[model samples]
Target: MAAIELRNIVKVFSDKRRGRDLLTLDNINLDIEANDFVCLLGPSGCGKSTLLNIIAGFEQATSGRTLVGGKQVERPGSDRGVVFQQPTLMPWLTAIDNIAFHLKLKGVGKAERHHRAMEFIDLVGLRGFEHHHPSEMSGGMNQRVGIARALLMNPSVILMDEPFAALDAQTKLEMQEELVAIWQKRRCTIVFVTHSVDEALVLGNKIVVMTKRPGRIREAVNFDLPRPRDITSPEFNDAKRHILALIREESTRLAQAS
Candidate 1:
């Protein structure tokens, strides 16, 4: 069975002021296999994040179904972890404590929580700064803390909505490398949403492109480029070219329609 399934999903928003409903997603169907690193690639306002939210059980689809591990997703659950564009860490909590906060809520003893959280701290390469609060850490470091917090739950899938969009170019590249390493080591299914073709190519084994709103799957491109991918290689450029063409085509069509 697929790790995550979106069956004929559709989403609409009530535009109260406009006195109409705006369709954001239309007849989307996708199956993400276990351990597949899937990137949802699309332009801004294309509803990639909405689709992700549906999979994460944070939002309900207007119609159709989302299943994770063969079970219908009714609401947010521990089986899926989500990291947003912002780190959203607690300002007062230290890195380790923030990562272990969920465990603490479940009444886990302090020592056990610390022990468990430490593993993820090391995994995200925040070992030395584990005691620092969010306010003290750099944006990249805080993002790592958020990632560690999600992983400490040991969720089967991770849903990320452009988590590196806020980082500086250098930090973004470093985080991308670290994220790929973590994904390889953890072997968990990840559905990442990003607008950047380069970021998608760098991180995903499969890239699912989406059209302009109302968003629909344009194509699912299999990218088998070896890890530590050579962005300058012919193969990488070819894939990027294909994806860019698709996006450009979509944009042209939308412009014509408008």
Candidate 2:
């Protein structure tokens, strides 16, 4: 069974000033298998973020339905963990506390919460910084904490919305490698949203590209490049060429329309 499904989903936002409803997502259908790493890739304003939010249950679709683990997603829950673009950690909470906050809501005890969260902290290589607050951490480090917090929930699926977009190149690469390692070990399904072609290529086995606003699936491409993937490899270049061409065409079309 698919771990996540979106059937004919649509989203429209009211433009109160313009006095009209602006369509953001067209009727969309997607099925994500359990343990799959899927990336939603497209140019900015393509509604990829909106799609992620719907699956995360942060926003409701205008029509159709979204399902996670065979249940309709009406609201956010611990079953689907989300890591946003910016590290949304609680500034007032220490690293360990932030990671354990979900457990706290579930009525887990202090000693147990800290003990459980410590494993994920160590998993994300945040070993010595458990007691540090968000303000004390670098952007990448804070993102690591955010990831750790999501992982501590042991959710079946993790939704990441451009979670590394704010990091420097060096830090981004490090985090990507770390994330791949974590995914390999954890076997969790991930739905990652990003506009970066290379980021989607590096982290996802399947890539779904969508159209500009009022987004519709342009293509769902599958590539089996071996890992750890070599960006310089001939196979990698071939795949990149194909995907880039599709995106460039979309860009040109949009530019002409405007």
- Return the top candidate by TM-score: 1
lDDT of 1 by residue, 1-258 (tens): 999999999999999998999999999999999999999999888899999999999999999999999999999999999999998888989999999999999999999999999999999998889999988989999999989988988899999999999999999999999999999999999999999999999999999999999999999999999999999999999999999999999999989999
Query: Which run of 10 residues does model 1 get worst, by summed lDDT?
Result: 145-154
Q: Give TM-scores for every candidate, taking all chains together and pairing residue i with residue i.
A: 0.99, 0.96
Tell me, by lDDT, which candidate is best: 1
Report the lDDT of model 1 for residue 185: 98
Clashing pairs in 1: none
Candidate 2: minimum summed lDDT over ten consecutive residues — where? Answer: 218-227
Candidate 2 structure, TM-score to reference: 0.96
> How many steric clashes between backbone atoms does each model show?
0, 0
**Local distance difference test, per candidate?**
0.96, 0.92
**Predicted structure 1: lDDT:** 0.96
Please list the Cα RMSD from the true structure of every candidate, rounded to 1 decimal place: 0.6, 1.2
The segments of candidate 2 whose C-alpha lies over 4 angstroms from its true place after superposition are 255-258
